[model samples]
Target: MTRRRLLGLAALVAALLVATAAVVTTRLVADRPAAPSAGPSTTPPASPTPAPTTASPTPPPGADLKGPLNLLLVGVDTRVSIPGWEPHADAVLLLHVPAGLDRAYLFSLPRDLVVDIPAYPKARYPGGRTKLTHAMSYGSRVPGDKANPSTAQGYELLRATVSRYTGLRIDAGAVITFGGFDKLVDTLGGVDLYVDQRVASRHRRPDGTMRTLSGGGYIGPQMVYEKGTRHLTGWQALDYARQRYTAGGDYTRQRHQQQLLRALARKIVDEGTARDPQRVEQVVAALGRTLVYAGGGRQLIDFAYALGGVPADRLTLVVLPGAGVSSGGAYRGEQLKPLGRDFLTALRGGRVDAFLTAHPSLRVKN
Candidate 1:
């Protein structure tokens, strides 16, 4: 029998930790963040998602977060002060890392996931209770209307909820706001992706027009399709990843994002192996700048080491056991419900551990 795993709650529950560094990368130099705006360079446009941070990545020995670990990546929809487009999470993922790992398996969790928000502070939220989407909003949504803070707070809320429910102790937390999302995709020279369906064509168009592109086309505000795999720019990647309507809504979009991550992981691994240390560093730095993380270095390294411990064949995205949509209950943006039992079962039995044992563990010094 598989024992349920506890979602790591406390570790990631703290507020955001901002890593403000005048970092340099392939696109932008250390001293100048706006430098890349001048012209094109050898590096891809390095715009990262502005993730409000909480913790620095952790590095340790004999700690728990090794060998087949599962992580939940929260994409917060923050209202950016920038001109057009209201902020909303393009997607959310319940990503899993292997014990003794290197990479991670990502599973998209719809923001509108209909589940019990058990840990919601009753004193704060007197409106009874709500769906899981609030978990993501907790960081920014300030009950009435004071002012939204950062994505870091949202991850903390989610971490708490997941821990209260699943009982998993995660290593860290991070958020990729809409602004950060656009930048990161742009920085990647745009991520190559494909959409399986038709979706709404505008970011904030009052006119309800929907255009369907094939598979290979430059993405922007409309659905562009070409065939097979094609190159995408930042805006295009965001549009592609943000397309939930084509795949019947959030589920399809989430899956598409997962696919993109797989491709991205492959590219990154290849870059690292090719000994393009400089290039890899550039990418990592860009990622660090944009991604608001609870922790860094060791946390990511441990997850990587644990993930690397498992075989590719066994690297599977463990679906948190449960239903997605509630029977007759539906909320505006809410998508599915987390399977309480299934989530715990996977964790306690260490489904990831079995995978780690199947392969081999990688040792790293913190």
Candidate 2:
């Protein structure tokens, strides 16, 4: 059988590479696909830190490195927000890599999650309750501000907001656009994934058409994906990741994102992308150009090498338990109760395994 068909929560530890290597977010339209032969472009915009040289030191087996690492992964709707569109954080994932770096835990924060945002200069609403996704945009939306809303200042606000919610110190982050993600997938050839159930998307068709359904809901005319093992290109992967209308709703999309996240990391490891100097340079350039990074590329490479051996079965996906509620009779929101509060406490205490053991239901089973 294909890898996707055989895939499950078997060994997800290697999957931690996606977040630990470089927590990514974005959706830029100008992010055209680099030519197949394209080499690294002139130094990518100012990176989180200077790029490392070929002779950079590697961590020794027992080196005294920092303890558990917490990173915030922000995926934005930059593709649909060019020019006149409003940018928002579509996917927010909290990645925790323990000091051991043997396994990883990923927490998906729903975009529609309601939370209190601290006041910041240029924020549309100075300190008020709003959707978690709006924090990034609000940080750079001031009139006459020339800064890009998804860059430096904007991401800091997002990091702060996420840190507040998770109670974990977020040290680094990365933002990748839908377009960049698509191209990256294509660059890796394609990814294979298993679906627990059939999935349909509400995204527009290739011809830019969305079939309207009864009750005013819109989805692809044909089912976007069927249950079983499936090979997905960049575009198809994005569509699959955005299928919130499926049986599990937004929860399903979060699971799919993790699935894709692991699949991509697997492809990178299997292909030895990091070991290849030219390929590494190319990837660094593309990511630096298309995604925003809060940490240096060297740190990302170091973590990737350290965690490359982890098996997929070791990776655990955790979704904060919550329920959907209609707020103000207009916007839909998700509220996590005891589970949310309790999870943060576990995180603060560095006892996620205990927490997960106690509450297995929150674990993503697929």
Angstrom error of the Cα, residue 181, model 2: value is: 0.6
Which stretches of model 1 miss by more than 4 angstroms? 1-68, 82-90, 98-104, 118-128, 141-145, 194-221, 272-289, 296-299, 305-314, 318-344, 351-366
Q: In terms of lDDT, which candidate is strongest?
A: 2
Write down the RMSD of all candidates, one decimal each. 13.9, 10.5
Error of 2 at 93 (Å): 0.4
What TM-score, computed on C-alpha atoms, does each candidate reach?
0.61, 0.75
What does candidate 1's lDDT look like per residue over 1-366, in tens digits?
Answer: 000000011111111101111111111222223322456567754576645789865533224554444456656566556432223434655545544454344445556655455444521542224456676555344455445444555566666665555566665555666556556555545555544444444442222233444477434454445445666665565566666556455555666666555444344333332134455355455555456656534433333223333332333443332334444674334433334354445555666444433333211000
Please give the TM-score that candidate 1 achieves against the real structure. Answer: 0.61
Model 2: how far is 108 from its true place, Å? 0.4
Candidate 2, lDDT over the whole model = 0.63
